[model samples]
Structure formats: C-alpha cells, structure tokens
Target: MTSADRSSDLSRAGRLRLAVAQLNPVLGDVTGNLELARRARAEAAGQGADLVLFSELFLSGYPPEDLVLKPAFVAACREALDTLAGETADGGPGVLVGLPWREGDKLHNAVALLDAGRVVGVRFKVDLPNYGEFDEKRVFQPGPLPGPLGFRGLRLGVPVCEDSWNDEVCECLAETGAEILLVPNGSPFHAGKPEVRLQVMVQRVVETDLPLVYCNQVGGQDELVFDGASFALQADRSLAFQMGEFCEEIAVSDWRRDGETWICESGPRVALPDTDSARWQACVLGFRDYVEKNRFPGVVLGLSGGIDSAVVAAMAVDALGAERVHCVMLPYRYTSDESLADAQGCVDALGLRYDIVSIAPAVEGFTECLGPLFAGTHAGVTEENLQSRARGTILMAISNKFGAMVATTGNKSEMSVGYATLYGDMNGGFNPIKDLYKTQVYRLAAWRNANRPEALKGPDGIVIPENIITKVPTAELRENQTDQDSLPEYDVLDDILECLVENEMSVGEIEARGHDRELIHRIEHLLYIAEYKRRQSAPGVKITRKNFGRDRRYPITNRFRDRS
Candidate 1:
C-alpha cells in the first residue's frame, strides 16, 4: 500500500501527491514569470508531485494595475500561457496556473489546467471583489465555472482564486463529477484575514465533502503582499498540509481516498503567529520586499520620536539592518527639548546612524519666499505645514543624494483625516505604518519594545522612548501644536474611520453609534478631501481591511457628500 492507504487519520483519505509553489512575480515580466513557473513545475515534478498549483496571475502578475489595458501585454501573456501548456505535454506533472486568457473580445482572469503538453481545461473567477484593494471587475471579465478535467482516471475541478470563496463554483464542480477541488489564489494579506480564509475553506469542504487544496501567491506587489500560507482541508474539515505564512515555500502533500470521498491526511501544521504578530511580521516583510525588489540601497525618514515614526524606524531596522536605516531629527524653532531628547533616545536605543538636520534654514527660506503671499494672512497651521514641508524637502534631498529610499511614518488615523501634510510629511518611498491605526501603533510599539520578534533586528528595551508615547501627540508645527488641537482623540478617530472605511457606514450611521454628529461630519470631510494626498502617498503594508490605497478610491474632484 502507498503512504496514503496506510494513514489512518480522516484528514488523509485520498493519497495524491500535490505541490504548492509560492512565487513572487514582477508586474509585466511575462517571460521571466513563465520561466519561473516552469522552474517551479519542474521542481515539483522532481519531488514526485502528481499536480502542481501556482498562485493567481502567475503567468502575468497580480495587480498588473493599468497594464491590463495594454493590448500587447495581454497578447504576450497569452503567448506565455501557450508556452506553459506546451511544457506539460512532456509527460511531467499536470500544472494549474493563473493567467489572463482572451476569448475574442472578452478577456478573463483565468486559470489553465495543463496536462501532457496541452491545455486541458480552464476555470474562471466568478466573484469579482471590487471593494477594498481589488479592482478585478474594472479590468478582466469574470469567467464561467469550468468542469472537471479527466486525468489518469481522476476527475479534478479547479476554482480560480475568488471562485472558491463562494459555494457555487465548488458545488457546480462537485455536481459535474469533480472528485477534488483545487484553488489557485493570489489573495493579499490583511490583519486577521487568513482566519477568514480558513473558515471559508473549511465550510466549503464540509459542503462539498471533497478534499481541497488552497494554493496562494506570496510576496509584495506595489502596496500589497500576498501571504502564501497555503493549506489543505480534508473532507472532514480537518487541516492536512499547512504551509508557512509570509514566506516562500514549495510544499508537497499526499491525498488519498477514504470510503467514497477523498481527503488529505495531516503531514505538518505550519504554525502561524497570532494576528497582531503576523501583521508586524508582514509589515517587516513588505518593507523588505519593496526595498530589495525595487533595488533601493537603504531607507531614510524623519524621527519625530512619536509612536508612528518610532515604529516605522523599528520596522525598517528590522527589515534592513540598523546600518541601512538612517534617521533624521528635523527640529524647528518651536520644537520642544523633550521631543528632541526622545528622538535621540530612540536613535541611541536602536544604534542606527542618525543626524540632527535643523529645519530653521529651509523654513526661513520658504517663509521669505512666500513672504508677500502670506504677508497679511495670519500665520497658523500654514506655518506649521511649512516646517513640515521644510523637513520633508530636506529628507528628500538627503534621499536623492545618498540613494536611500524615504520611509514615511503616517498611520491610518492621520491619513483618515487630512492630518498629514501632502508633499510635506507624506514624502517617502514606503510607509510601514500606513495601515496601522494610532492605537495599533502604540500597542505595536510597546509590544516590540517589550518582546522582540525574530523579524525585528533592532535593539530591545524601549526603542521608542516612553516620553514619546506618554506625551500628547503634537506635530510641533507651532509653539503648542497638539494633535487634539486639529483632530479628535485617537480612540475616537480610529473608531470613526473603521466605521466609515471598513464597515462602509455613512456619517449618519456612524453618528448614530454615539459619536458626535459634527465630529463625524468633520472627519468625513477630511477623509474625502485627503484622496489627493493619499494618491501621492507612499506604498505601505496593508494590515487593515480597507487601506487608503487600492481599497478606497474616492474622486478628488467629486462634490458628493455623505449626508445620509
């Protein structure tokens, strides 16, 4: 008997060798990606895999963004698919891969099942998730459910990524003689998202009574990263083969038939950290991938000694050693001694290279230049933004000179409302804290300081000064510029943003939840007005359900208000 027949666990019912290849594909690199896919397939075949599944858009790339509009790019993707299909004819292993398929005028976000060097079957995505970071509907057309492909007398159904989320695809396949369901996904990572996936997959398995293999893509793409964390759910809703999260791995598991149905027996359970811990690790990974993949030498950012920048600096140090992280303290005329001391404390604690670049010179230059324009205007937040702009310009200059990318440190709370300066404090190549709310920032800071994870390379023991966290948050634009002076408390602000952004609750709905009406309105106005700033903002780890980029797209020129 094979290993599958000998296994007694319900999780291992059908013994079929399967391989999941977690890959990172560069956008628009058709040739490179196809070759990478072939290499992965060859590797899987070497491991004795009967079938290998790849992540979504593996032939092209996830979130090809506007490149899907290019006709030539689509044609190149199709040609690459043809090459992959031709390879399977070598009598190697069957392959399930994501690609953009063109059928006359309709282009589909599809997965092709290849066997014996020929295209055997194709499954199309049914559910087009447009909300949040997905714009699938805006690009490719949804495809019809594909029936099972008969191979070696075993009928297999392939649900291309989003199709597996709903029961229709799996149900249709099961009804059409599909004994097993294989899902190829390019699902992105968010805080607590994998659990949701697990719940959904388990439910699908229970409903279909068929063993399922959940294969996902890995690595950062633009502002998003797909955490592989691929897993297999047996017919009895038990986890069989669990792959590692937030990393690359070529995992192989055997599935076998038990009684009348097939199931995957336990091979290994890849333990995942807690939700918050995973978010922290994902943030670090996102930063590393964005910097290294883009070929940036290092990173630089303003060290305000606040939780936001402090946490970002810590992540940067963890991502690219302390040697690669450059911290700058841009103090202005109104900057307090405590802030300065706190900034220094973080620098000293982390042992990173830092410099105190006073913004007085540039601030004075800008004030003198705009002297006539602001001659009669009362100097208020405009002056504070001037200080921020000065600091931003200085950091950008240093970045340009030293060939290091700037890491912006704005959290979701600041980005929710128009609290951040557009081209000023918002300047950076990446923002590690963009998805984290202010509360989350503080919590993560404390968590990192107290218990350092393996991903964190910085020194321990309060890398973010206590004074920075305890002190009232202030931009220090003017003499006494507290964040509360311009916005609501973080506790209140994050709640409103979550209701508005994630839950899609309107202003009235949020106000009904016991928040002040005027406060909600003000926050709403700030969020709507800040689209332009977010558009130009740096890419960051997407930990929340709805991040500023990709997830939420508001018109910068719209006049519509959420009065309801």
Candidate 2:
C-alpha cells in the first residue's frame, strides 16, 4: 500500500474539519515563521481539525521578493519546511503550507501537503502575478500547469493564488479529476480589493465547478498591508464562510461531500466594514505593524492643527496607545492663535502628551547664518520654508533623543504637487496618510470623529475637533497664508490630482471634465517636477490601487508633457 493507504488515522470519511490560519508573519524570519506554523498547527489540532490550511509563503513570509534569489535563504526555507513536515509524525492535523521550494536549479513558489508524518504531495504555482505591487516572475520561475493531488481518498486541486485567477490552471486541474480547490493567497489590501477578490474567486468557482477555499495572510509588510478576509465558497458559487478583516484569527469549518460536490457544513459569516471603516482599520493596522516591527518605542509628529496632522495624530493614537504618541507644536512668528487652540483641543481629546517648542530661535539662527547669501533675495518661499525646516529638525531631534519615530503627515495632493518642502516638514520615518488625497484626508477625519471602530486604540467621539476639519488648511509659515495662496483649493486640487496621478488622464481629457486646460497643464507640470520629492518621501500604507511608491514609478529627468 502507498503511504496514504497505510496511515490508519488518516482517512477521508466524506467529512473533514479544515482550519484556515489567517495570520501575520514577519518576512525573512524563517525561524519565527516556523514557530508560528507550529503554534498554529497545534492550535488547529486542539480544535479537532483534520487539515490546516495556511496562506501563501507562510514559512518564509509572502513576497520574500529578491530574498528568494539568495541560495542560503532558499535553503533555510527548505530546512524549515522539512522540520515542519516532520512534526506531523504526531498524527495531528495535516498541513497545507506554502514555502519557497528549490528544485535542482529552479526555485518556485510552492505549497506542500503534509499528513501522517510525511509530505504526501507538493505542487508549484502555475501563474506568477506580475502586476502592481507584485513581481513574482522577477524572482521565481513559474511552474508548469498542474493537476490534482490525491490526499487520502479525495482528489484535491491546490491552486496557489494567481493560479486560480486564470482559467487554464483550474480548467486543467478539473479536467484531471480534482475534487475541490484550495487557494493560498498573500493578497494585499487596496481600496475595493476585497470585492475584486470575491468576484475573481467566484468566477473561478463557476468555471471549475469545484468548491474553493481561499486563505489569505493578514498583516503590514512595508508599503503593503494584507487583510485576512479568508473565506470558502460552495460549488454553486454561494458563500460558505466569511472571516473578519484586519484581524488575525484561525477559523475552523466542517465540510461534507454531497455526492460529487463538497459543501461547508458550518463556518463563520461576518459583516464586513464599509469602505471608510475598512480604510481606517487598514491604516491603523499598517501603522501599528510598522512601528512595532521596527521596534520603535513610540511615535512623534508635529500637530500643526491642520486636517492632515490631526487625522494622522488620531490614527497614531489608535495604532499605538495614547501614551506612546507624542505631539509637538512648533510655533513661529506667524503661528495663528486659532491653530494653537485647535492643536490643544486635539491633544486633549486623544489624551496624548503634548509640548510646545518655539521655532523662532532656530529660524533666527539660520537667518543669521545665511544673511550674506540672501543679501539680494526677497523673503518669499525660501523664508517660509525655513520655518518648516526648523519644525522638521525639532521633531527629528525628539525622535533621536527619545527613540520614537517621526510621523510625517503630508497628503497625496501635497506630495503630487511640489507643495511640501524636502528635509523640512517632510522629515519622518513614515507617513500614515501619504497615500490618501487631501479630500480623502478630510473625509477620513470626519469618519473618525463620528465612529470609533472596535479595532482601534484611540478614544471615541471627537478625537479630532470639528474646527480642525472646517478651517482652511495652511502651513502657517506666513501671516494669513493658506494652502490656496499658492495652489488651488483642496477640493479642486485633489480632484485634479486624482485625475492626473491615478487616472493618468491627459490635459485635454482633464479639461473635458470642467477644469481649465491651463490649470491642468500647470498641475501636470508640478506632478512631473515633484517626482524627486516623492522618491525621497517616506513609505506609507497603500489604500489606493496606485500609491506613490511601487504603483507609480516616473523618471526624474523627463521633459515630455502631454499637450494632447
């Protein structure tokens, strides 16, 4: 008899209890990831799971990227996989785990099925995704079209992520007698991505006529954030189970075969948050993970009493507790009384530590040092920028002394245009609201004020003062200087920016949308010239399909402008 037949305790009795581990794992830490796998497998065993399914690259962590190219790293992953597979000798739950598998000379994104103290089968991913924020083909070679793996007495189709997204892989598996499809994903979150995943999975189910289980990883990795909204769908394309998003949970479900088809007997079905709620949770989760993973003691940011900083401050309090978020107000000669009051109101609501440091000393010192250099120049943008640089320097000093990360708070609208100063207010380790446009920042601020979700760490009801949102946004560098003094209004600016950055629309196309043509040209020019600033900007969580870092890569020395 084969190993599958010889294992007495391992039998397919037309019913199976499968557990899905929606977990967060740190990349490049194979030892930690292995331990995580061990704990999760043990937990699933305690819950009486027949088999446990983990997300893609659960051992080495997903998107190991260029790390897979290193022979030593690939070897470490293989060793960990073998150790994990050996643990199944306890006759506990079987594990369908993902890892980087190195064969002879080829390395692939692969998953192995383990049971009865041995690896029963191994399958490599067929389709390697190479789109936005994904470049699997760059690091690992693609495997050939695959068939089903016979586990116990049932035939199982295991399609790793992108395999199920295309019809060829699933179609091949189904034609070769696969019973059910289990998809392992390391899918990251973008606005509307959850719905996009559902539609894609539904289409695969419809095409293959097989029940599918999608298990996704949950956590923040650099600029990307994964939401573990794992679920199962029956052959009829009906929802079998729906797990919660932005939280880690090992959910178990019972599945029974109905003639030739399998259906989930029972599993969790939860109400997902709307767009605004999901976006907030994503930001909080991303920010929290970045801080904790990097081992920052806390975070510090300038609370300028503007919507952007207020929103970022509230998010910081939500991600890290109030005790860990430090807000400093750097006042100068042009500082407004209303701004000071608003900043105080925000700190009181969030209940975080607040301090006021005057930038007059730093600014005056710099002016004295540069008096000869600026003998013939007017006190225009340069003088105003000195104020911002002073604040940036002060925040950086606090960060260096207290071991807290500086949280830069610049929205996409400011970054897209050259409105923000480099090494000045743009100084930070990370920006929580970098991907959000100015209008979206206002919207999220309003959302946070009205409702505090259960997942956040901040307090509820008016964490951001209403005046902060209603008032005109400004750098407060000069007397009565507002953002509109140089650029258009935020509402108009954000709309135009979205068209240019996200939509990549031409000047004429933007003008067709009721904006002036010359304005579009000017905005387009600003967007191109600001590429260097964005290149030096801090990374943030990606909420949109095209964020500044990975999604949009433009040349810094380009001269082509779309006059069409």
Candidate 3:
C-alpha cells in the first residue's frame, strides 16, 4: 500500500481492539523480555486484538540503568525488537513495545510500532525525567516534541511514560492530527502515586479533547515496585477502565470513533485499596520479586519482638510462602522474656520455622578480647553495638549455610537518625520496611492483621500479636533501653524526617510547622551523618516519595548543617 492509501485507511475507524499488557520485565533481560512480549502478542491475537500495548521499556526492561550505556546491551535490545517485528508477518496484532534505540551518536528511549513484518513507525520519549528516582538525562538524549505514529487505520499518539505528565507532548500530538492517546509508563508506586497519575492524565484529556489510555508496568524491580493500576479516560474526562494494582494483567479495551474523537467503551473498573493496604501490598510485591528474581532459596531475618522485625517477618511470609521464610531470634543478655514470648508467638502464627540463637557467647567473647585494649574506657555505645554485631554475624552464618537471603528489619525512622548499627542490624540482602517510617510500620501491621489479601501465602488472622505492636520499641542492647533514650519519639521523629527528606523543607520551615528548632537541627545533623550507613544498607521497597537510596542523595563527609 502507498503512504497516501495507508493515511486514508487510518482516518476511517469503526472498532479497534487494544490489548493493554501490564507486564513485569527483568532489568537487562532483553531476550527474555522479548519472549514475554511475544507471548502477550500471541494471546492478544487470540482475542482478536488489533494492537498490543506493552509498558515502557518492555523489551529492555524499565530503567536499564548504566546497562544501556553498554553498546552490546543496546545492540541486543535492537536485535530483540527486530525479532518481534518479524512475528507480525503472520497477520497477528501489531505490537507497540518500548526499547532503547540508537541513532547517530544519541541514544533515545524509543517505542516501536510493529506491523506486517516490519517496524511501521517509532516515537521517541520527549520528556526525559531527571527528578526523584529518574536520571534519564544521564544516558538518554531527549527527543523533540513527538507527533502520533500511524498504525493500521489510526493516528495513535504514543507518549512514552513521562511525556504524558505535562501538556506539551499531548498538545503537540493533537495538533498533528492524532486521534487517540496511548501512554506507556513504568511509573513506580509511592504511596498515593496513582491518584497523582490520574489527575495528570485527566488534565491532558481535558486539554487535548482526546481519549487517553494509561498503561503502566507491573511487578517489582530492586527497590522499585510498579503498581499496574492502568486506566483509561474518555474525552469527557470520565474514567473508562481501571486495572488492578501490584499484579501483572492484560486487559482488552474496545475503542470506537465518534465524530472527530475516540471514546473508550465501559470496561472493568477495579477499585484500588486504601493507602495502608496499598503500602502493604507494595512491600509484599517488592520483596517477593527481589527474592524470586534473584533466585534465592528463601529468606531469613532476625526476628526480634519489636514491631519492625515482626512486621518484616509477616511480609516475608506473604511474599514467599511460609515454607520459604525462616525467622531467628538472636537474643543477647538484655533480651527480655516478653521478647522471647512475642517472637515465638509470631513464628507460630505465621507457620514459619523459628529458632532462638543466643548472642551472649559471641558478645562476651568480643568484650573479653577488647577489655584489656580498652583499658579503663567506659562501656557505652561501642559495647552496645557488640550485641548487634553478634546477631548480624549469626544471621549471615545462617544465610551462608542455607542459601537464604537475610532480610534486615530497620524502619526509615531508625535509618534516618543513624540509629541502626551498620554491619550489624544492617547486614542483610534486602529490607522490606526500609522506606517506611516506624509509625507507618505500626499502621501497616495493624492493617495486615485486620485484612488478609488473597495474594498472601501466609495464614489469615492476627499473625502479629497485639503485644508486639502495642509494646514500647527497644533494641534490648542494654537493660531497659528504649529508642527514645537516644532519639525523639517516633511520631515526632518521623514527621521531622519526612520534612527534611521528602519535602526538603528548611529548618525555619520545619520549625514553623510546630517543631522545635533545636530538635530539627539535631535530626538534620543525624540524617546527614547517616548517609554513609544508608549507602551500605540493602535495597528495600520504596513506599514513600523520598526513599534513602535513589530519591535522596547526600554526601556523608559533608559538614554543611542546616543551621538556617
């Protein structure tokens, strides 16, 4: 067919079947991801889908990181895209898959439209996001304002992920004769991010008078979890469809042309869970994918009677089955009877294997060896850290023996203030609650007890005892030691940290929020000093806007205190 003939055919559309594939692709797994796209295309063809839409970077996986810099990796991705394009010769559904494309000296985050055994057209992502968890500018060259790609009888405006966040890309497409807007995203979940996304899409819909289909990637990747709550908005700014969150799905939507605009017919609209439930599910999915994708046998964590460890243990069981999770109590001299009872209670409730390993033997050995060297030095934080080191050593030994990943159980509150012991409690493969504040941890534990998600592999009921959640949190390093002895109360500390970390509020701004200036300064100092510890900490689920790893970056040796 000639170009003019194809353009005329695209203008007259009756019913178009679009299969939105919300899939999870492993980072740097180009060939494997291509196979995933192939399978989804086959399934969509079986359902008579005219087109299959995969999430951003479905071929090379989202955020390929420095791997995209390697020429061989980019070549592999290009090869994979070509192979998938060849499969369209069978008259199957045309595929729109995201991959890294190289032209001249610049590499672009490009989406390819495949049909009839060839790449029909390609649209580069214009908006290269550089803020928050994105560093797209480091590797990817931004494409110019993109117009729509012509697919079989349709002028489809394809916005790659961040392109649809603002008005420019969609507006440019609408002016270029685009009929429908199909946005593919790799948007990671951070608390109420879905609501933020919906608002952004509605604005574009209202601006362009074009129906928008938002498709996001699903599953977890390292610290990032892509909640695939993909949806569609009609030209009238009404929601047409809503997909489920935190799971992989392929939903088919039927679109019809009405005069000069396209409208999505009514389809499935799955209600999203509340904030607490969503956060819990994000942690579960993130942890599960890390364990399974890394091919670990299971996970082992030091389960103290504290709320942090207890909640982590429950999440591990939910992510991996009970049989795959192992909990151990590394008790020291300060370990309380209440703690032992509570730890055992959690293990029993979750139906996971539990063991108690006393750290006294190792703790005493270390103290005795250092006694003479220390001379008359007083036993203080140094001595207290010995217990934590002993417990970390024991957990590592267990992990080495059984090939299970060790899960560190420090919440964001402790991490923010440098309260956690590095190479001690921080020695683990991953942390499920590393991004959550101590206060949020309590709320999630309570929510999990009251409601069990169908995706959970663990048993229902109160796995976390009320005592664990209700009791005062302690490290049990010394006699009757509480966290507040060294840090502020969790409620206050978390709020202050959130201001400093997430909001980037100045000392004056935070103080104006009813916080004492001195307290803010102290927390800010600790937060900066703790950068080194957070740098070494295991990657965890990112449940907040500013996680320690990617979202917030600070130097450890910096002396700049937020005195102002």
Candidate 4:
C-alpha cells in the first residue's frame, strides 16, 4: 500500500503497541546484528506488539565508523534491511530499524519503516554530529528535514539519533502531522549523559507538545559505550517508561490516541543507576564487548598490586568471568614484597588464575645490551622504562601464547602526563580505565569493593585489598619510587588535567583556579608532549566529555601550548 493510503487508514483513533529494542549491536557484524534484530522482532511479536523500534543503525550497528564508507558493507546492510522487510509479510509487527543507506551518490544515515513485506518509508538523519567523537559529517551526507513515517494508520515521526537533539527536525515532523515521535539513538554513555539526554528530549517535547519515545542502543562499540536508558516523555513532561542502563532490553510501550494526539500509556520503568554505578557498568560493558566482539579468548594483565592494576584486574574479572582472566605478577629487583602480597591478595579475592614471573633476567639482559651505549650517562627515566618494558614484554608474550588480549591499566592522570611507558605498560589490546583519573580510579576501586553489582562476575566484598587502596601509588621501578616523585599528586594533577584536557582552560585560567602558573605550564607542556604517546595508546572506554583518542585529537608535531 502507498504511504498516503497508510496515512489515511491511520485517521481512525486506536491503540498502538510499540516495542523498543534497547540492544547492543556489534559494529560491522551485519549478519549478527540482523539475527539480533530478527530475534527482537520475534520477541516483540510474541508480546503482541504492533511495531518494533530499534536504535540507530541497528542492522549495520551504530557508528559503523569507516566501515560505512565501503560500498560492499553498505550494500550488505541494505540487503539485511530488505530481508527484514520481507519478514514483515507475516504481519506480526512492523519494524523501524536504522542502517547506512546509499542513494545515487549520497550515503546517508537512514531509518527504514517496514510493514506488510514492504518498506513504507525511510527517513535520513539531518543533524550529523561532528564534534567530540562523532564524525558523521566526515562520512554520510546530512539529509533534509524529514517528515514522519507512515506506519499502521499512524504518522510515526522517526528521528534518527542526533536529529532529535535539536528543534528543527521534530518541529518539522510535528508541523507535518506527526502524532508521536520515535527517536532512535546511538547515544554513548559518559558521566551524567543520561540527564543531558533527558533535558534535550524534554526541550523537544516542550516545543512540539508531542509525546516522544527515546530509544538508545546499548553495549560497547570500541571506546564508546551506549547506555540503553531508553524512555518515553509525555507531552506534560512526565516519564512514561525508562529502560535499564548498560543492559539489553526489548520493552513494549502502549500508546493510545488522546483527542487528536497519541500518548504513551504504560511500560517498563526500570530505575536508572547512579553515576558511579553507571560509569562502572559502562567500563565493564565496554571491556567485555571489546574482548568478545573481537573474538579474544579472554584477557591477561599484570597485577602490580597497585590501585590502578588492581582495579583493572577487578574490571577484567567482572567483564570476563574469573576463569577467563589471567593475572600475572611481573616483579623485578625493585619490586616490593608488599606489592607481591597485595597482588596475590587481589587474585585470591577475585578467584582468578595467578602467576609470578620474574623480570630480572630480561631487565639484566636489556641493561647489559645497552650498558655500553649508556656508559657515559647516569641511570634515570630510561632505566626505569626498561623495567616497565620488560614487564610489558612478558605480558605480551603471555598474550601471544594464550591468545588472551592484554588490558592496559594506566589511568587518565598518568596518560595525560606521559607517566606511562609507551611500549612497556602501555602495551595492551584495550584499557578499561583509560579515561578515568587516578583519583577516580581509587574511588571506583573503593566503590566496587563496598558494593558488587548483580552483573559482576567476580566474587563479592572487597576484591581490591584495603592496603592497595590506601597505599601510595608507585611504579616501583626504583627503590622508593612513587608517582608523585615524577608528577604532582593525583588530586592536584587530575584537577589540572581536567581543566586542560576536558575544559581546554588556558594556563591563566587554570592559575585563576588556585593553581601555580609554573605548575600549570609544566602540566600543559607535558600533556601536549604526550600526544605522540597517546596517539599510539590502545583504545579505552570513554567516561568523560573529552577522552584521549576520539574526543580530543591533538597533533603530535604541534608546538602550540595554552600559555595564555
């Protein structure tokens, strides 16, 4: 039937059963994603749903990245959508799914509405996000303001992800006779991002006086973690339903025509997790998806007994079950007995496989080889780096032998100031706490020890030793080495880095915040100088507005510093 025919049929007032599939999609896994969508549709059908709604690019997966550029990949996504459309012949429930589409010479991020074995309508995203990790402008073309899609006798306004963040798209849909707004999003989780999303949607609702269903994709896509906190906002600004965060769900919301408008009646209303719990879940989900989606057998990491490594090990255990996590203590001559005990304590607490490998032989061999070259110079950072490199090598060798991915444990504070060794401790397939500040790392460790989420795979109650959390953090490359010896204390360092990295505050602006000018300048210089190191670092979960790799991109060769 024609779209006009469908619109005319929808003129009669009735109730519509809408299913929101808050699912996790693996990027570039078109077949897997298709299967996922098919299962969700079946589930919705069984639940007596009139329509199934999926997050943005549910078939191709959200933020397919550069994979969308490949015509073959786009073609595969289109084929999958067509196959899904054909399945609608059963007339169980229509499907509204997002995918990358190509028409003529333009590639657009589009959503297709399928009903009765045919694509009723397709709407393209208008506001292609470009800043802060989004590169939609770099890829797909921005489409014109779209009208609502005709679905089952109703004008369902479909806004793909970023379009609903603004007024123009939803406004146009409302003006064009859209009764209810369904926004499919690939919104990633950052600290307090849910509130931001709600505020944006609230503004749109207030403007258009339309009840909106905000469906977000859940799961980890590399550095990005989509918190599937999907919900419906009524015209009166009341929440109709709220899906759980950091988990997959297919919730059905009932909508009934009210006088000339449609309003959400009732559905799932799961409570959103607190900020800390949400962030921790995001980290765990991101790590798990990275390892599993990439087909890694498991993960391996060096358990230094330090807060950073201990927390990472806990996250690893939580992400992949304790059996899949291998914790190795790579000790050198300067490695402390306390560190050894703490490492063992953590492993025992988490019930993961533990190993102790001495790095003395490798460190001695490296020193012996480079002894002549360094004969005239005093031992310093280079020597300390050798120890880290030795440990990193041992972890990589373990990874190679066991087919386990390495989890780098460096936090944002260390990464910002180049405190981490490039090829040494930085060697890993992924870093779960890459964007968390050292202070935040300690807080997360304590939080995890005190409370275990139902989703955690590891044993409950203080997996990280209290001593590990209380002790002064150190690399232990020297006799009494501490991180503060090379850089400022974490409390001060994180604040400065937050200003410089996240806020992009100038040196003077930072100084105005009660920090010394010299200290700010030094930190800024170090942050800029470490661009090359960060450029080579592994991708990690993004927990902040500005993360190292995707959110904040800096030139390695640039000499510009915010001296002002």
List of clashing residue pairs for candidate 4 = 10-153
lDDT tens per residue, model 3, 24-126: 9998888789888988998888888889999998888888888899999999999999999998877768889999999999999999999888898998999
lDDT per residue, candidate 1, 25-87, as tens digits?
A: 877889999889888888988987877888888888897766878899989998998888898
Kindly indicate the candidate among 2 and 3 with the higher TM-score.
Answer: 2
Candidate 1 error regions (>4 Å): 1-14, 85-91, 455-462, 506-512, 557-564
Q: In candidate 4, residue 241 scores what lDDT?
A: 90
Q: Candidate 2, clashing residue pairs?
A: none
lDDT of 4 at 192: 97
Q: Candidate 3 — which residues are off by over 4 angstroms?
A: 1-13
As a whole number from 0 to 100, the lDDT of residue 412 in candidate 3 is 94
Worst 10 residues of 1 by lDDT: 2-11
Worst 10 residues of 2 by lDDT: 2-11
Scored against the true structure, residue 433 in model 4 reaches a CA lDDT of 98
lDDT of 1 at 412: 90
- Model 4 RMSD, rounded to 1 decimal: 1.7
Superposition error at 203 for model 1 (Å): 2.8
Off by over 4 Å in 2: 1-12
Q: In the order shown, what is each candidate's alpha-carbon RMSD? A: 4.0, 1.5, 1.7, 1.7
lDDT value for model 4? 0.91
The candidate with the higher lDDT, 1 or 2, is 2
